[model samples]
Target: MSCKVIDTHSQLAYVVRMIHCVCNNINTAKVDAAAARGAESAACVQRACGTKFNCGQCREDINHRLAAWRALNPMLEAAE
Candidate 1:
């Protein structure tokens, strides 16, 4: 039998699915789109994605993704 080794610390193992606002059927793609379209804040994301103020569980997570996405793609920011 051949021995196979798996890397527990691999980056793929740490990959996380971005699910923002499940109640409103929103996902990472939607959030990214919104962020790219000038959603610099969670409130803006909620509004743009029609999430509104539901259970409020996704609020923090959305904000986090927004900040990260913006940091990575600085050019997506809308001109003020």
Candidate 2:
């Protein structure tokens, strides 16, 4: 008998703290923070927060969320 085993990547098992802006269960807060930290990359936030890009379909919303978050976190931006 032969058995094949599959492992889940640590990077992929991330759940961001998102709020459903459209009531579609989309986490915006997390996306925004991640974007501010990494922008297009988002990898840094992904690693730190363990939030996978599961919502690729929500790119537009993500962008919007990022902008809103930046506006809210002006001090964070200046510090960075």
The model with the greatest TM-score is 1
Top model number, lDDT: 1
Error of 1 at 39 (Å): 1.0
Minimum summed lDDT over a 10-residue window in model 1 is located at 9-18
Per-candidate clashes come to 0, 3
- All candidates: CA RMSD (Å): 6.3, 13.9
Q: Which tens-of-lDDT digit does each residue in 1-80 have in candidate 1?
A: 99999867544322455577877877777778888788877778888977686888888988888877766666655443
> Which residue pairs does candidate 2 place in steric collision?
18-27, 19-27, 19-28
Q: For residues 8-73, what per-residue lDDT tens digits would candidate 2 score against the true structure? A: 653332344556333334465556656667564334444435655564555465555566666666
Q: Each model's TM-score?
A: 0.68, 0.43
Q: Which sections of candidate 1 miss by over 4 Å?
A: 1-17, 78-80
Weakest ten-residue segment in model 2 by summed lDDT: 9-18
Output the TM-score of candidate 2. Answer: 0.43
